[model samples]
Target: MAQKGLCWKEDEMGELVHTGTSSPDISVIRSLAMKHLPGSYDTMDVAFFAEGSFNKLYCVSSPHLPQDYLIRVALPVDPFFNRESEVATLAYIRKYTSIPVPKVLAFCSSSESELGFEWILMEKIGGVPLSDIWDEMPVEAKESLPTEICGYLKSHQDLQFIKIGSLYFSLVRERVGTRDFGETSAYPSLPIVVLSHLHINS
Candidate 1:
């Protein structure tokens, strides 16, 4: 699901200047899969999956793996924290909870060689998005989902973070989490809620 965006540039004054979501062609996606995936997956069908404001997602499927894979590529000008922050976010979630999220198989926070983009390849979570099937569910199922959602949210209370930003893992990939913005003075560890996969009307 690649979208063409007009590349914008800024002047030396650093004033508001340009914006566009970077896109990767299919060949590049295939090459990336071949480079990073297991050798057994000699071939893969890389199909465009979806896109968000700052990211384009592609679905990678191979007979070797039990499930399909997803590649999430971040735009060069992503307004949110860097790609590492996203990788760390998913890593932190995986380390801390049993809530089902895509398992981060491989990621490059910094653009490597010709890739020129930060990307993550992971096991895709299977199911129709809650948004797609939400209103069609029976009232009982709809009521029951919130209780499950609240239960999941409650699980985050144990996760304590002092800053109001994304969390990142250290070199050893354990302990000592840091925010995307450089660290600040010690503050009270507050609870955070990541409203992903929820269908609440905002």
Candidate 2:
């Protein structure tokens, strides 16, 4: 028989153990699998692959299908944290470019029922994540990645104002300002180069 979702392991003091999957609030894995997926997978089992501060990622498979897809369950971190916007952004990117993003299968925003969290079902991309590849990838591949990313940006250069938000730069500014003072601080600078190229191309 297939294994069910993991249960919280507790300590002798009756407090929850610090497992990677343990969260302070709740787990929406089962609700997401049952509600968002196709009718065929309504009764299928789900296994949690990972969880982030903002979302829980799971791999779901059934006897009917040979493969599994990823489900991203958005945790309500704040009122302004919109899972719908993230889904829409993914959909918009997929519609405009062939840069290969996860294909959005379904998205739900209502938070009224058993599925208390907003979620998105997306086609899983196969490959080692970029983090895993960092140490293994060749220098040439590393160099080419930036070029490929730049080409992707260039492809969407002609996008209308409505398609891409107007305050995109401001978003970048905010991210830069709020970023940690460590290695991650460099991320905010990449937008400057990309924006400069975009301006020239437009």
As for candidate 2, its clashing pairs are: none
lDDT of 2 by residue, 1-202 (tens): 1111223467899885333332322345655555656665535667777877566877877776555778776655321225544554565567666668898877665444355556677877877779977999899999999999898888677444322222222334443233222212323332221111112212
lDDT of each: 0.65, 0.54
The candidate that achieves the highest lDDT relative to the unseen native structure? 1
Worst lDDT 10-window in candidate 2: 192-201
For model 1, the stretches where C-alpha displacement exceeds 4 angstroms are 1-6, 9-22, 78-81, 134-139, 172-202
**Which ranges in model 2 have alpha carbons more than 4 Å from their true place?**
1-43, 78-81, 131-143, 156-202
TM-score to true structure, per model: 0.69, 0.55
Model 1 lowest lDDT segment of ten: 190-199
